[model samples]
Target: MNSPGTVHDWVFDAIGTRWTVTTPSPLSRPVLDEVRAEIDRIDLAWSRFRDDSTVAEMARAAGRYPIEESDQPLVDWYRRLYSLTRGAVSPLVGQTLADAGYDADYSLRPAPQVSGVPAWDEVIAGHDGTLELREAALLDVGAAGKGFAADRVAEIVARVTDDFVVDAGGDMVVSPRTRPLRVALEHPMDPTKAIGVVTLDGGAICASASNRRVWADWHHIVDPRTASPVREVLATWVIAPSAMEADGLATALFFTPAAFLRGDFDHHAQGFHHVTIRRNGSVEHTAIPGLELFL
Candidate 1:
């Protein structure tokens, strides 16, 4: 539903999710066209649900695959996430997810004998402009792809207006003009309730929750080490300079501790801030400038 409110909000569907773009004024036709093209490019390169996507091609063949320069940054970020999470988050887990019934068809029926994910070093090697897959392996980039697309759209919007908000699903990038944007953090167990609120001056915020996608006894967040769903964390939210980083960190917090990530990113000028809710109902959050929790 595209509506023109006081802020000029446009909502649409893309990449298997909804998106909303808000600007000081209406977006130009050229900007919208470019945004759509960029989204299509991202979906073609990273979507595992499509048969003709680049990831699907890698799943069918094992060899050196060339990729666009624009795609290289995401590959690098995935490598960083893999190392930071100690292999808990891996692109090679696509087959494991499919075997557990989260395949392209969304079968939701686990295979009788699910296979373990191959080691990162064993399955693939990264090089400039290309990746060498040792064997056929399905790669899933859903973790950060949506956020990257959001950032890309924000870049397009910035070309026209300096102040805008690009929201791809729940991953958002904000460029405020004067005051900060107030964001409600939705409760993991109940969408109608808000657990907290954030005052985002600028940059990006992303969230991940186990309760968002579930079927039977399983959820979308699977532990690659055991080839099963993770039950430790209920939800996580991250605020960073980039939506891609925020999105990846939101998932990484599920597999790793916040302290480790905090220590690593502390060197930055405005380091990332995060909020975590464990399955035991305990909440952990950093004392940052923009976060406020009801509990």
Candidate 2:
């Protein structure tokens, strides 16, 4: 459902998830189709499930390989995130996750216990667009790819209309012209009930939860150091200038505490705001002057 000032919403499927675009007015079918294609491009490049994707190819190589210039943005972002989190959220955790039977199939069946995960330092990234992997590790971009795609979709939407909300699954880039968009944070433990409702005007919002993609004791987001599922925080919401940053920050908050996030994520200049809901149903949030969290 749209909030006050929106005209209608367009819903479809992409990137292995549903995508909806809420706008003040309906967009042309051609523009909508273009948006779909753009999102699909991101999936084709980063999806680990696909046999031909760049990420899958990198995983298969397990050795020194040159990355495409087009993929440099993703590599740079990951490197920054790795440094910021102090390896709490590493791209190398993908191998550990796959070894633990959390492969693209999504069977969620428990696999043999993983011993340890590789470090981001081991995978040498060069400024010349080359990535040399010292050992084998799957590079998972699931953390920020969808949100990045959402931003790209929003960019496309902005071309036609100034007011729109591009939601790629739970990662959203909302640009509201008339009024604020009402966004509800679903209970991480119980999806049926919402924990809070917040207003999003002209920024991106992404939520990371341990329960959304869980089966057994394992979930989608895995800590690189421990090679285990995150448990302390049930969910985290991040609002940032771009959906890509917001999405990665949401996952990073799972592994790293919120207090340390400001400095690590350059929250000052970027105007980053976060809300964390722990396993005990407690909340910790940065005090944004006008934003209200209705719990």
Query: With candidate 1 superimposed using the best TM-score fit, by how many Å does residue 40's alpha carbon deviate from the native?
Result: 0.5
What is candidate 2's CA lDDT for residue 171?
A: 91
lDDT of candidates 1 onward, in order: 0.87, 0.78
Model 1 residue runs over 4 Å out of place are 1-5, 267-270
Compare the candidates by TM-score and give the number of the best one: 1
Error of 1 at 26 (Å): 1.2
What TM-score does structure 1 among the candidates reach?
A: 0.95
The number of the candidate with the highest lDDT is 1
TM-score, candidate 2, is: 0.89
Model 2 alpha-carbon miss at residue 216, Å:
1.7
Per-residue alpha-carbon lDDT of candidate 2 for residues 105-177, written as tens digits (9 for 90 to 100): 8767777777477666666545257777665556788888788788888888899987778888889898854
For every candidate, C-alpha RMSD to the true structure in Å: 2.4, 3.0
